[model samples]
Target: MVEIVPYENCYLSGIVDMILSIQRDEFQIDITLDDQPDLLDIPAFYQKGSGNFWMALKGSEVIGTVSLLDIGGGKAALRKMFVKQSFRGAQRGVAGCLLKTLLTWSASIGISDVYLGTTTAFLAAHRFYEKNGFLEILETELPPSFPKMSVDTKFYRQMIKPSYVLPKRADLEGKK
Candidate 1:
């Protein structure tokens, strides 16, 4: 059975491998792990303030990953969503599960809007986001704090109802 859980240090290697495989091998994106500094220090970059990362694992292997970075003002930027081809599509449900997990967490933690940037090559991703209520948006509409990747040519946004108070930075410190 596939299980979705918060990221842990022990799973870093597997998560990186899965992401690299999906990007380089499957999608043929000519990017390296070194280009993504956040992958090197997920705990510091994500998992702080309103940011978070998660993994979808089957047994000891990571099959998918996703992350949300808090850009302040009740807004977040979605990042690093990749799923192994074997676990993709409606039949497998990996991508949908990971997205739902992120959105649910965002709503519970007082996040009002979630934005994402993607490359033009991700046609399936565009359809996926649209089907899940994310509307196509212009880059200019993104928050100032939104991190725009060099390869990103498309943007999307989704509004949600936040249910709980957001945790303070101090509350998350030293708890990784």
Candidate 2:
């Protein structure tokens, strides 16, 4: 069984490890030690009225993570979303659960929109976001940390209103 919960101190190392693994295996990105953000940084951002973070777990294993970063005003950016490759298929539902939980939390805190930036290489991810009602938007300037390597990057945004509703059965059905 999978569980979505607030990040705990013990889960930090696992989260970082999984992120590093995904970067190495899937994205071919290398993150240096200084570039690594501490787990406390996540909650600290939220505590400072910046953003929120959560983790996904199966039993005692941390498999995925998502962050809702307050870009300013009432806007929040959905960033650093990832789930381990080994946990795909039905296990992928954990990601959706985490996203829904984050959206609910954002709504409670008055954030009315969420934005995301991803690379075109991740076609599956783009489709997943679309299935979840996120709209494709034009790409903005790449983040300073991102290598100027790709010109096919994409950006997406989703409005988060009190009335915003996810397709209940469709999301469960995993149809893109």
Candidate 3:
């Protein structure tokens, strides 16, 4: 069973491992730069209450994570969402659960909308966001930190409207 929990002491390493695994296994297109932030940096932001973060776990192992950085009152930005490949098939509902939990928590705190930036090369990621009701928005200039080596990229946004359907755990039932 998959469990979603707040980022706490023991889970930090698992989160780092999940991110490094994504950087190593999933991000092969670019070797000139590392896409992940330092693990230690995560807690500083969370500790400042500038953001909220969570981890998805099966038993004692963390398989995924997602975070929301509060941009301001009624606004937050989505960041660092990833799921491990070994845990990918039918059990992948954890990703949706993590997202729903974050959205619900954001709404409770008056976050009106969430924004995120991602690469066009991550087609599966784009599709995942679209399936979760995110709309693709044109971003003319890439973020300064984003690698300049790649010409292909995209940005997306999702308004946290009441009509948005936060996927239920059942939605991923039987999906492999």
Candidate 4:
């Protein structure tokens, strides 16, 4: 792994290509970049307030992504979390690295609740989120500002306490 870092314009093309590949090719999810406008302008959509976007890179080739969108009132929506098929697993730890990075940033920014929505097709993802303390919840429980996608059928929320101590990004940032 090269490193996990904050999103930069230099990574824009790689990010979109990798995510769309995973969604459409690997997972067979019919989503388009037009349907996801955030990918086109990540800084404007995700890099404001307490929100931010990140990419896991392999020598500048984007292999994974995760974003935190600050909805409001100490709440944020976890979005655009996708990992390439070849780079996923407990051993590879690409997904873990991305989630850890996002959580650490969310806690630092005083985000108390992080919500996310996904389809039932991602069974592994459900287990991963549950393993990381994200409890399953109904869509009605989500806050008004969460950017709910049309394909998202299942929802979850992870609560972060102000004084919570999550491992620092360095734990996985540059490690190989």
Instruction: Choose 1 or 3, whichever is better by lDDT.
Output: 1
How would you encode candidate 4's per-residue C-alpha lDDT over 142-161 as one tens digit per residue? 99988899999999999997
Looking at model 2, which ten-residue stretch has the lowest summed lDDT? 142-151
The order by descending TM-score is 4, 1, 2, 3
RMSD vs true structure, all candidates: 7.1, 8.7, 9.1, 6.9
Which residue runs does candidate 1 get wrong by more than 4 Å? 164-176
Deviation (Å) of 81 in candidate 1: 0.7
lDDT for position 6 in model 4: 94
Better of 2 and 3 by lDDT: 2
Ranking by lDDT: 4, 1, 2, 3
Which clashing pairs does model 4 show? none
What TM-scores do the predictions have? 0.90, 0.78, 0.76, 0.91
Clashes of each: 0, 0, 0, 0
Misplaced by over 4 Å in model 2 are 38-40, 140-152, 163-176
Q: Scored by Cα lDDT, where does model 3 land? A: 0.71
Q: Model 2, range 1-176, lDDT digits (tens) per residue?
A: 88888777788778878877886667776554356554446677543474778888999898888888776767777777888887754445877887898888888778877878777667778888898889987655323332222323687778887645668996889976
Cα error, residue 126 of model 3, in Å, equals 0.8
